[model samples]
Target chain A: MASPGPHSRFSARVGGTPASISEAAGQVMAIAEAHGYDKAARFAVRLAVEEALTNALRHGHKGLDPGTPVALDVEMLPDAMRIVVEDQGPGFDPAGVPDPTLDENLNRPCGRGLMLIRAYMTEVRHNQRGNRIEMTYQRPAP
Target chain B: MPSPESRLRVSQDAGVTLVEFVDRNILDEANIQQIGEEISGIIETRPQPRLLISFANVDHLSSAALGTLITINNKVRNKGGQLRLANIDPQIYDVFVITRLNKLFNIHADTSAAMSSFQ
Candidate 1:
């Protein structure tokens, strides 16, 4: 099979609730499979999406309502699948996020989300505001 | 009694608290929090708990869940307890390796191996 084509693209505005995130993530995963994404690629996409949306609710909208909505867009190409998760909150600095791998932070229970995203995804970028994250998952050759 | 929504299936084997996940994807926030609390409660019940978490059923995991595991690890350490993780699928194992958590955790290839390492 070829890469994930444009015809397989979809977008959803999902809340932070478990049901909402599961449904949205399921849809993207199914589409990815239809486009011939392997288990590893599908796994990466799912983790990145969950972490991005969860970050929006937990960090970006900390004091805000948990039900506040965020945008999740998945676009597929022959070579890569791009996902964007944007939240409606004051953005922070991505560079300021301390390295989770540091010896001091190894026991820290949080902050590894962003690091995982950066590690798994072929590419990860945060907007100037830092509330929006765009990630690209490069599909491995068949 | 564990809550109806309990995400873990826990049992006792040779003085060890063996735990497994009920869900395939341990990625949800509320569920992760509940699992953390439940495991934490188990850790508190023993003077020095020996916890062995198996990932046989878990297919997807988020960093939040990793945090929960770390928190559990810390609690186990503070209580003079021990913790072991096993049966992680290849994909999920890669996640631990990338986050450098593999270095921080005592991981085994299977339940038997982890169980044996407890002493």
Candidate 2:
């Protein structure tokens, strides 16, 4: 399959280790910053990316070996940012996550990451396998 | 590179343990783990365990850090104490709001305000 577009694109295979996952987030933020994204915008993208990667490491690679790889692909468009995070692990249903905002679930920590990603990004889509997700954000007009 | 302990400054006032974090911009895994350990230390060592986390210098934090905060909060609650947060950047504050954690914790404008809440 051909790559996303003519715009700037970055791809990496991040190690499943905690430190490497964080490092990948840093690289994604740097790329967003270099593309003229402001602080808040960059932060939103960074948080979403980190959350997605963390989910992959925590859920996708749960019972597997420690060094499984998580794939990251970012495409910077003229007015948007697109990111894809793919993990090689057992896929699960994201919709099954409990509602963290509810009073009963308020104290639980399980669903906050996905909530934040959805709140920050313009669109969040998961593949049928649930091991991959694509998130996009439209840049604020200058 | 400043050690996570150095980057996270802890002080005490009026029975409240105040934690001040200095993250140039983001709180990655290392800082989150360090702060998590520090919070655990506070729970273990402090007699009453009242905590007020200050984010005056932090720009952003990952979800893992948020999980750490939730864990810390639960620990404090288990001890029949409280955990509050103060001086958070507006953008960072939005994260709390989006996650609905702003309602779960006692958040204030500054450290002094948060301190007064403990009384």
Candidate 3:
């Protein structure tokens, strides 16, 4: 399928892991503001994007060469903003994640990222490539 | 990079207290706890217990950060006040919603609205 139109109406690109994650987030907020999203909605989008990017950077590219690239794509519509984060690394099983809220895992430092991603976005899915993930934010009713 | 430190600013009229985080990485769980302990200290002292976090300088956040916010919100609510959020960077906000926290806290567009929420 063809990509969404330039006016349909959002997009951005970033290279590398850490900086790419930050830039991806900045792009999402800029798009939200341009579309006049409410504060709560904007916050939700930002958090979801951050978690996805962090996963890409931390887990996806944990020990890869620093030269490896991570890419972020964002599209904003009238009612929602969709984000995609792709990385160059071996993908892992999303199903194997432990429950973050469990008492045994509560004090652990890193398990909650995926849990937070699932909680905030209206939809969260991983692509077959395993290194690519997509998330969406729906505009809350006024 | 600046070392992690916690700062608190009070806004009584808005019934919201703003906690600004200047940390190496808000994504770190230990940093989240340090920040949370400071905010909790403030809430423990306040008679009304209202809060609105302004994460203006915070660049990133992790699930621990989200949990810290939730814990603060519960503390404030138990005291008959509310915990809201403002000036959150998009990166951190995304985590908030992805974790379904947007549904739990009264996040505002700016400090003004978050403060006014208690009225």
Candidate 4:
């Protein structure tokens, strides 16, 4: 087995069963806190992570069998934290998501996560298949 | 339905039911469900359910929590009642803004303001 590096590292495979997002978020938050993320930063990371996982579960895995795997990887670096959430289901187009902030869609609940993820994270990117999302949050300078 | 043991505090002011969520952070899915059920119960039992959910101490909420609030809001309106929110943290309020729930619910700066608006 390869030895783990000095930097903080976390990896988990969350089962696709119902209500797994909460558990995934909890674990991510714990890892963030362990690396000295402040309350606000932790909150942002937690929210973004939850939304990403939920999207994977709700949109990516639709019509698929339960127990599909949602892979999680977290790397705490000196300047930032990087997280990758990937699912085994079909991907989506990030740009095609409607703007929830528009007057017509203001009352609707859709697109909230997309907005939040963009707002909180320093950078957010999706794989070509759209089934995988990568989010990065820059650690606040002391 | 969420049981009384959920530790949700209830108070009345200006005929408005102010629900103080015990969990300072409404992130867990189970907690979100419990709060949703509690709000639903309030909507069903209150003759004129003008509710003001106080998030004074709550600093964090998940998207599922947002969905729960939407469901409760619909139930309150369908029951011929009203639902508002007050004392939400700025960060949490931003969630409402991003989700555009700010336009859907009557949000107040504080519980006092929310109560007065109901009068």
Query: Highest TM-score, which number?
Result: 1
The number of the candidate with the highest DockQ is 1
lDDT of 4 by residue, B2-92 (tens): 4668748887776878788887778666677777877788788877789989998798887677878878888887888888799999989
Mind giving the per-residue lDDT tens digits that candidate 1 earns over A38-95? 8888888888888888888778988878788888888888889999999998988999
Report the C-alpha lDDT of model 2 over B16-73, residue by residue, as the tens digit: 7888886655456676777788678879876668889998988878777777888898
lDDT of 2 by residue, A1-142 (tens): 1222234888988886777876787787777777788988988898898889988888888998888888899988889999999999978898988878888887775678888889999999999989998999999888
The regions of model 1 sitting more than 4 angstroms off are: A1-6
Ranking by DockQ: 1, 2, 4, 3
Backbone clashes in candidate 4 total: 0
Residue B95 local lDDT, model 2: 85
Instruction: Show how many residue pairs clash in every candidate, following the order shown.
Output: 0, 0, 20, 0
Model 3: how far is A80 from its true place, Å? 1.8
Calculate candidate 4's fnat.
0.48
Best by lDDT: 1
Show where candidate 3 strays beyond 4 Å. A1-11, B1-20, B23-60, B64-119
Q: Provide interface RMSD per model, one decimal.
A: 0.9, 1.6, 5.9, 2.6
Cα misplacement distance, residue A6 of candidate 2 (Å): 12
Chain A accuracy as TM-score for every candidate = 0.92, 0.92, 0.85, 0.90
Task: List native contact recovery per candidate, as a fraction of 1.
Answer: 0.88, 0.62, 0.29, 0.48
Note the residue pairs that clash in candidate 2: none
